[model samples]
Target: MRIRPITRDEITELVDDLWLPFAGEMGDIDEYDALAEDVDVRAEALDYRRTQLDDDETQTFVAVSDDELVGYTTVAYSESPPVFARDSGAKVKDLYVAPEARGEGLGTSLLERAHEWGRDRGCARISLSVHARNDAARSCYESMGYETRYVKMDRPL
Candidate 1:
């Protein structure tokens, strides 16, 4: 297995397939907010990512095994919002590893690459959001030195 920046051709061939498993993992988090059957998640995500990938502030890295894309991470540097008391930093929007690829350290490799990317751009920090129910990902992030910044509690009432 190897890790590298995603090539344009690979994006065209693998983006949709990659989204499926990623979506499936998130689906396990909560049925109430799961992706709708008709949503075409990958198609929309692909279009959005393609545009973002053209910008200098965004970077995506992919993990390949046996010539197939097994996982990927996407991160972007952003200016602090005017109304928010936050510093400019890199935010990791997606980190997906196929189920079969989970134990091989691809996720860690991708995350480390993201940290390097952020540090290279002089970012103060790199951050990400994991669903509260997603214990595995949360554990992984915590193990990597990430700490809870805020707890988002939701109520249907």
Candidate 2:
């Protein structure tokens, strides 16, 4: 497998493909339909990510094997909201490895490349958020030396 920076034209396909599994994974929850109700919202979100990719502050990397796209990741400077304390580091916004590629080290390889990209930008830390129910992903992150720093809880009103 090999890792490289994402190309400009690959953004749409990358974002769209990742959302498929993401939505499927969350479909088990009752709130998923409500959250995914607006198709336009999905398009807008992809557009937003496309725009961000043009910014120097954000970077995306892809992992390839046998000339096929196997995994991809996106990292950016952590945003600091005035109301909440945020650390100064590169925040991994997305990381996805094709289900068939899970056992391989593609995810870890992508993350390591992200760290090098962060270090090149003078970032002091690397962070990411994973859904509580995604135990496999959580375990992978933990095994890679990541720790939980924050949690957001939700419930039906």
Candidate 3:
């Protein structure tokens, strides 16, 4: 298995692979289902990724095994607000691994690449969001030394 920056030719496949994670989220959370019903997520993701392909501040990485795309992650650099001590940080927009590919360390490998990318760009911190109910993902991130810096609470209307 290898993890590398996604190529233009592989964008469609990457978008297609996104369904695995999206579907899981939709099934696991009511909010995700409501949101997905309101938008064409696949198209939005494709366009979002395409725009980042040439942008220096953003990067999308894919994990391939046996010539098949198995996982992906997107990271972006941004400056913190004036209130923060750190000037800049990197945020992971998305990260997913296929069910069959889970437990093989693809997620960690992809994140490690994101770390390298952020470090190369002089980012002071790296951040990502995992759904509150995504226990597996939260556990994995916690094991990797990620700590929660904020909590987003919602009261459904």
Candidate 4:
């Protein structure tokens, strides 16, 4: 259980596996409206996420077990936290532990690493968005001492 920097090869390997399912669990009404405007906005965002991982600004980590990629988390700053927090904050852009990997403290380890990554950047705090419907993840985050500071409002725009 080492927390380390994500290499290019690791990013490419994890992109297809982690991005879309995470994207599908967004604020529904907002995603729905955006789909009406252009069906590919979510796709574009996933692409952008991968690109950000490739860029210098974003950082990521993975939980490797027995030489297999099992879990991952990403952190990004320099414009963060959805404006709910001030600048110089870091956002947990992604966190996922495969079904078999959950409950082993991997998520917590990944989160701790992400926050450490934030602190290393001189960030004031770390933040992330969880799906309103994902009670399990919400609970996990809450147990980890993260509170719901902002509710992403959703209505037909």
Candidate 5:
């Protein structure tokens, strides 16, 4: 498998594969279904990713095997709040590997690339959010040395 930064012309292809991760999340969390119902997700995702193509602070990477697009990740540079000790950090906005590609380590490879990108930009840390109930993903992240730094809770009124 080869991993590289995606070009503008390939944004459509990347967007096409986005549903794999989205569907997975929807299946793993009930809240995502409500979230999806509230927006035109496909169009919104396409528009957002398109904007990242020309933004220096953001990056999108794709993994291909046998000339077929299989997985992707998007990461961006972020500034910490004034109360935080760190001035800047890297946030992994999204990371998804196709179901058929899960056991391969594509996720780890993609995350390593994100780490390299953040390090190059002089980021003090890297962070990402994961659904509380997604055990598979949480385990994968934990194995990669990611720790839970905060929790967000909600109750319906």
Candidate 6:
């Protein structure tokens, strides 16, 4: 598979293709529900990611197998945010792969490319947020050498 940056025209396709990784096999909610526990994300909430990709500070990446889009990701940066990342170090807002394509190291490959992108742009660090309930992802991040700098928590009555 070839990994490359995304074009604006692929926005909608990206949004739909994202479900493969984030939601699992779509026709049935059972599989999606099982994976959902590991990711702690909803399809509807993904709309925000789609919107962010179209904004000025955000960027999108895609993994293509043949002519098909197998996976995609989103990253962004704030010129004035309180974080300590490089002026070029983008905060990775999204990273996912097709369910059928998982376990094949595509996620690692995707991040490697994303890191290169950040470096090319002068980013010293690539940051991202994952849900607390997403244990598998948390493990993946940890294995990738990311450390917990802080946490955001909330409880609703």
Between prediction 4 and prediction 6, the one with superior lDDT is 4
Worst 10 residues of 6 by lDDT: 25-34
Residue-level lDDT tens digits of model 1 in 64-136: 8889999999989988878987678999989998888888778889999999999898888899988988888
Which RMSD does model 3 reach against the true structure? 1.9
Q: What is the lDDT of candidate 1?
A: 0.84
lDDT of 3 by residue, 23-117 (tens): 55656675544445677877887787789898989999999999999988899999899997766999998898888999988889999999999
Error of 6 at 74 (Å): 0.8
Can you write out model 5's per-residue Cα lDDT over 1-157, one digit (the tens) per residue?
9999998887777777655466656665875444456777678867887888989999988898887778888899997899978769999988888878989899999999999999999998899988788777788889999998999888778
What's each prediction's clash count? 0, 0, 0, 0, 0, 2
TM-score of 6: 0.72
List the candidate numbers ranked by TM-score, top first. Answer: 3, 5, 1, 2, 4, 6
State candidate 4's TM-score: 0.76
User: Best candidate, TM-score-wise?
Assistant: 3
Q: Is candidate 1 or candidate 4 better by lDDT?
A: 1
Residue pairs with clashing backbones, model 5? none
lDDT of each: 0.84, 0.78, 0.86, 0.74, 0.84, 0.71
lDDT order of candidates, top first: 3, 1, 5, 2, 4, 6
* Ten-residue region with minimum lDDT total, candidate 1: 12-21
Clashes of 2: 0
lDDT of 6 by residue, 1-157 (tens): 9988787566656766675446553324333245545553555545655676567666778999877788877767545356744354677767888877888888888887877777777767788887666776678888999898889776657
C-alpha displacement of 81 in model 1, angstroms? 3.9
After superposing candidate 1, which stretches have Cα over 4 Å from the reference? 82-87
Clash pairs, candidate 1, are none
TM match of model 1 to true structure: 0.88
